[model samples]
Structures are given as structure tokens and as C-alpha cells.
Target: MEREFRICSECGKIMFEGYVIEGGWRYYCSDTCLEKNYTRDEFNEMYGDGDTETYYTEW
Candidate 1:
């Protein structure tokens, strides 16, 4: 097993792989963090603010 530590783009929380949200090529710890990191207009540009869903994909 491997442990990867990443800083949340919004709140700066320490997170592992399975606990995160993705938007605009960035990783956040939660949907609230994603929302905080981006504005309505900015998020709207990313195909609308998703239903606070966690996006899972490789970086």
C-alpha cells in the first residue's frame, strides 16, 4: 500500500486519494471547498456547478 498526501486547493486540508473533488484541473477536499475556490461564473464555465458531486479521475 502507498500513502499519498495532497493539499486541498481550498481549505488546505491533508487528504488521501479517495477523499476529494475535482474541478478546473484542481483537487479539493470537498464540494464546499470547490465552491469556495471558484465563483459562480467561473464554476458555471466548467459545465455548471455539478450537484456537489465528487469527481473521480486520474490527474
Candidate 2:
């Protein structure tokens, strides 16, 4: 992993030690940010390939 500072996909915040990553594609700093962007079901319906394991990104 590069371990670089990633910008939140939803709030545009800097994620330092903690961040939510979806399928190594998009990043979220928190659950609030994730939900604000897309609900789990909604996200799955669109971007997900039916595997929800990658959804547990909150640290």
C-alpha cells in the first residue's frame, strides 16, 4: 500500500489513520460520509458486484 493521505470521496476531508475504502476504488473518512454519499444498498445496487464484504471500511 502507498499509505498516502487520501481525500474523502464524499466530504473531501483528509483521512489520516482512519478511512473507509470501497473495493480499493473510493475512500470515505467515516460512516456519515459514506451514507451521505450513498447508502449501502444503493451503493451495492450501482457500484458493487453483489459482494458486500468490501463495504466494511470504517476503522
Best by TM-score: 2
Which lDDT tens digits does candidate 2 get at residues 1-59? 65667678877888764334455577877778878877777766654664653454333
Clashes of 1: 0
Task: List lDDT for all candidates, in order.
Answer: 0.56, 0.64
| Pairs in clash, predicted candidate 1 | none
TM-score of every candidate: 0.46, 0.49
Candidate 2 residue 24 C-alpha distance from true site, Å: 2.4
**Which pairs of residues have clashing backbones in candidate 2?**
none
lDDT of 2: 0.64
